[model samples]
Target: MTWLPLLAAGPALAATTSRPWGVLCVGLLAAVLGAVLGIRDGVPGHELAIVLSALVAVTLASGLASALRVRRERVLAAVRSVAEAAQHALLKPVPATVGPFQVAVRYSAADAEARIGGDLYALVPTPYGVRLIVGDVRGKGLPAVGTAALVLGVFREAAYDEPDLLDVVGRIERSLARNLGPDDFVTAVVAGYPGAGRMEVVNCGHAPPLMVRDSHVMAVAPTHPTPPLGLRALTGETPSLQTLPFTDGDQLLLYTDGVTEARNHEREFYPLAERVARHMSDEPSRTLAALHDELLAYVGGRLHDDAALLLLRKPAAVGSAPAAESRASVGEPTRPSLLQ
Candidate 1:
């Protein structure tokens, strides 16, 4: 779908901020100008009466409205500051230029800032190509956030030092085992981009990454899969790394259970594959927007848990060849937008 519907509300939302004063002043000027123009069509006494009444209304309305808006603005300003701080801590930032492809990210927590939980995504450039992780923590509040931070910290370091993707998974498991209780566990998908137009993926009880090429999506998962990260010790099994074919203009999307498990008013699960087929083009920025919008629509506005998505685009040509592909534009690390 086009983004027109989302753009329509931009002005309305801007109306609630300090910036709104500029718009309000412009509107008042327009009203005065219209009245002056109308005076040409009316008698002196009538025009004066109308102008006087309009002035009183404008003064009283602007005064009371300004006071109320100031209070609301103060609250929102504080909220935005805290949300931005938390967002930076939880999902730092990644470069748009990773090897060959451009990377862009959009993350949304169900609650404004202190309230968001359950979902997380991060991409860090490691010595072993660009390593990425996308997964959901099990619960909410500082506890869930702690679990998520635990996973990401282990993944980033392991991705650089460990040569094998599966080994990286093991490292994460050991870290969690030490930090989390025996019952606590996290489902995750960890992948290594070797920058050779190929990907090595290990699924630790997480959803498969959606592969896109030429605007088509191909499901990519290894024939052999492993249990979730924490459960490896419980199951006495280690996960295997899965390799899949990839080409330039192709992208791999790793998302949390939140996206697939999301339900609607009819209680039907969100159609992940179907929507991907429609929006999975050569452009990841657009693809992400479509997926994010579809997700919001499915849940009817607000999400109930933390949700995350990480997208990787493979270059059209690897090694010795230079071919430009789609890009994920990185924005200034401001508070993550509510739109996502």
Candidate 2:
């Protein structure tokens, strides 16, 4: 009689890792064993019946629980699949090389299950030159994701249509003004690599981009302070275009606040410029990968906010190449050309 009570544990334990049918089999075995033990103990008929009844009840309940658990897991799997599809659609993957620059990107969402958050980046070859934007939307979750999608959509279209870098920023500002709430705003840095070895950067109240020159890393602060994307009306300040020389062997890194603000157990912020100098490499991908790994380790495994890093390195010209105009026709597209 004492041993018969332990039988209920078998079905309960099996429910965790087995199907309903498996739980039923475990319960059946347990019930048969319990009956034999009760008979051998010469327990009274009424007590034996009570013990058997309890065991049977536990089995049925465990089986139902197992079925419910499996169903919930399937539903979760389907939700994860849809989230992945949405991530790919919203944040299209960037190729290793875009135009003449070697490009690399690393992104992490605070919500591990979401796969994407408010951080956004886009790099595409335009008729003007290779252009890119790195920005962070206010807040998190689905609203933040929606704002990110809106910003990227406007940037991709404006990058090809607008000749001037500032014009591209204007287009985004106007679009956001119409859509975003009063307090919602996005901080962004829009950049273009036109001819003349000069890169045009428009800072819209975001983190200054870091430029690596001759093994040195320096922040490219905005010439004029400006409000974020949706706050032009409140501040009445406009973003200014700062042009910097981008020559061979030069690299530029644009990242969101999540990277810089990440803290360790000691609460020390990650030193991005120093790490970038330390991890400098000919390949942009390798550089970002090292930084990404270090960032994760610094935060003790997971980030609490959305983080994004985009690195662009201009390699030395190999030899004589076709004219910019000729290459423009082949590279210029509405969407970035995915590398094979």
Which lDDT values do the candidates have, in the order given?
Answer: 0.68, 0.88
Model 1 bad stretches (over 4 Å): 1-80, 317-340
**Total clashing pairs for each candidate:** 3, 0
- Model 1 TM-score is 0.69
**TM match of model 2 to true structure:** 0.91
Write the residue-wise lDDT of candidate 1 on 127-201 in tens digits.
778788888777777788888877877777788899878788888888887888777788888877776556778
Top candidate by TM-score: 2
Number of the top lDDT candidate: 2
Q: Candidate 2's error at 124, in angstroms? A: 1.1
